[model samples]
Target chain A: MSSPKVEIIESYCKGCSICVEFCPTDVFEMDGFLAKVVRPEACTKCMQCELRCPDFAVKVH
Target chain B: MAFDYEQYLRPGKLPHIWCPGCGHGIVMKGLIRAMDTCGLEKNNTAIVSGIGCASRLPGYVDFNTLHTAHGRAAAFATGIKMAKPEMDVLVVGGDGDGVAIGGNHFIHACRRNIDMTYVLLNNYIYGMTGGQFSPCTPVGAKASTTPYGNPDPTFDIAKLAIGAGATFVARTTAFHATQIDKLIAAGLRHKGMAIIEVLDDCPTAYGRRNKFRSVIDMMKRLKEIAVPIKAAAHMTPEQLEGKVLTGILHQEERPEYCEQYQQVIASAQGD
Candidate 1:
């Protein structure tokens, strides 16, 4: 299977770090006040980021 | 293909008021997915919520929505369900709203076995009101009001619902993201009163004072503590202490209130 793709919508990201904190695979990193998917290879397609983001900022596929 | 969240959300409601890392969003996503999986019509579904952090959910959903008075979501939902009968009415609220001030309505609605779905978001604190301890707050947990530590015993909302005669009751946490959706869908499918108490995390309000290192830490703790009902059956009481059992806790078929009320109306009109 192909690796999962993770997208972080910068405008919706409030630097809450929920995606970084909740991602079981550590698929995200903080880039200033916004979350950046620095380790997309580790994305497990769990959609934890997409579901848990309060700002509706992340989407995983 | 991806789920088109915009298709189910109200425009200009983006950037919800929930603080960063709060679990209310996760529960909201689970509810929306449940609605999608059930193929519920937006025009036929009514979302009602009371005033609180979790109650803000109805405002974002694209449905017949009501942001009701504090602790009165269920009452409003009951009215909507009775008037429309065929409409799918869902109530969303936090622990404080559902169990504290609204506790009476919650139990009576279950007792009446009304055809409606209630999703109680139990985040342990009153998140929007600055972290006060709620009825579902774990005993001895520190809250803004209980800076020293809480003295009151906490409530088990699922058990309460079951005792109050709800036809369907279940519990799940935000960590079990997919399970949350499945349970919600099941609850919606049930014909009588259905209550799904979701253990959502309020990292800003509940976690910070409780000493969870981060949002992830709280989520991990939720996973660690949730024992599936089937698995819990084999465990000793000692092993099960302080652990929450996840899954359908109880369910039964009963004559729903709205259907029964319709019969009464028909009889009265005939007479």
Candidate 2:
């Protein structure tokens, strides 16, 4: 009964905003040119971040 | 990650080159999941691809991958299967790469009914070399090459594969993530040739030209248009128009080419 863990690989992030735009739960935010999982608690583990990230930057556990 | 994508992907190859919101990543994820579910040994699997955005997939995977020439992935994969029939061979290519320049090789591969799985990503245009019209490009759709609108007919890839004699054929879209994984696993397990056509979204190249507002818009459109094969039977032709039928379209048992060829070789040697 715990929230899904979301991790963002900074080096791989191109800050394309795909994860921010696609996540139905609004779990990510852009920090400059990189994406950060601001609301890990909101993570639904729907895999939108991981699947839509062309850079292979996001991982939702 | 809990999925262990690292085990299947080349971690050093992180930060892939696909455009933001491109559907190729979704397809890759589905393929990885399929591989995991099938319990395929990485070292024993051979991945082959022709030139295009989808073709770049093999470069990121950790298997025995060959980034072959444009439109020749199937031909190269055939050689790998012939050399070592024990190895699981998977061919990946885009619509333009697989059906346009490589159309001849594709049909022949299906006709041969070899033991291999082919994952064809149809984004409806030539994405890598600019938004050009491709064989799968929809009629009346606009592309860079087709300034006004595309006039050529589009190919129903699944029907073509079934007609060409592939033992297993299926279709799915990037929006249907879980279904993509299931279909890919089914394709891999099939004895003869299995062709899985994935309707992916090329947001930058195909979406913009086609008047799609964003990646989400394209994904929603795919969701709206996809109809399950079983459900399609109950729907009218009007309801079916513009709707892509997902799930296994055709499948049958048949003799695989490599095994037949080996038998021929043994008989000739005895003679």
Candidate 3:
């Protein structure tokens, strides 16, 4: 399997910082008011950012 | 392949009306995943809700949905289940709509042991109506209606369901996102009434008044207070103080209401 790819749908992100705060591996960072996938390589594919995100803005593939 | 949430979401319903960091959306996602896990057909499933922020959930899902009058989700779902016994019925609503205004209906439905899954999102305050202190709000928590402090005792929703005779009762927080789907899936598979109370967060309504600085703080609080049922058993009463137990709290087998009603009809017809 290849490394996981993390994406953030900017339109749906409400900038709650939930993904940034809860990611076990520091996979996301806040860019102004939105979440950005700053370190996709560190993603363990736990899906925490995708599942806990209230806005459904994060996706891991 | 990554799970496709769009397959269950209604078209053009994206950007839901919930507030920023609202936990309702997460609960909706869990419901969708549970339906998928149970292989529920959209045409054969019916989702119903009453008037509240959490009540708006049925509107976004692709299943047969009903947005009913305030505090009447259970009543409406009961009618639907009776009329179409084969259809899978699900009810979604908030603490106020489920335990306060709809308390009578809620308990009666449990007493009937009707075959339906009720996902009650307890956000403590009435978020849609501007942060009124609801029946589930903590006694000392502040809300718009309780400027000084909330004086009302909180309702333990899972206990109420179990006491009223629901066949299955479970409690989980929105922070436990993965467990939500598992519990809801279990409820869907159960043969009689199932109540799943999700401890949700309302950053805008409940948090601001309660001195939670941000949505993250509220989410962290949920994480802090929740202790899984298995872990709680090993802890002392003092250690478990102010902590809420999560996981399936109750389960039992009971004759479903619809099947009993059918027997009554057969007897009346002299069959």
Top-DockQ candidate index: 3
Query: In candidate 2, what are the lDDT values of residues B133-173, reduced to their tens digit?
Result: 99999999999999899999999999999999999999999
TM-score, candidate 1, chain B alone: 0.98
Candidate 3's docking class is medium
State the DockQ of every prediction.
Answer: 0.61, 0.51, 0.74
lDDT of 2: 0.91
Report how far residue B31 has shifted in candidate 3, in Å.
0.8
Model 2, position B226, has a per-residue lDDT of 94
**lDDT per residue (tens digit) for residues B120-189 in model 3:** 9999989999899999999999999999998888899998999999999999999999999999999999
lDDT, candidates in the order shown: 0.90, 0.91, 0.94
- Model 2, A1-50: lDDT tens per residue? 77788888888777767788889988988788788888888876788778
> Candidates ranked by DockQ, best first?
3, 1, 2
Q: List TM-score (chain A only) for every prediction.
A: 0.92, 0.92, 0.95
Q: Could you give the DockQ of candidate 2? A: 0.51
Q: Rate residue B48 of model 3 by lDDT.
A: 95
Interface Cα RMSD, each model: 2.0, 2.5, 1.2
The residue-by-residue lDDT of candidate 1 on B40-64, one tens digit each, is 9999999999999989998999998
Question: For residue B14, what is the lDDT in candidate 3?
Answer: 77
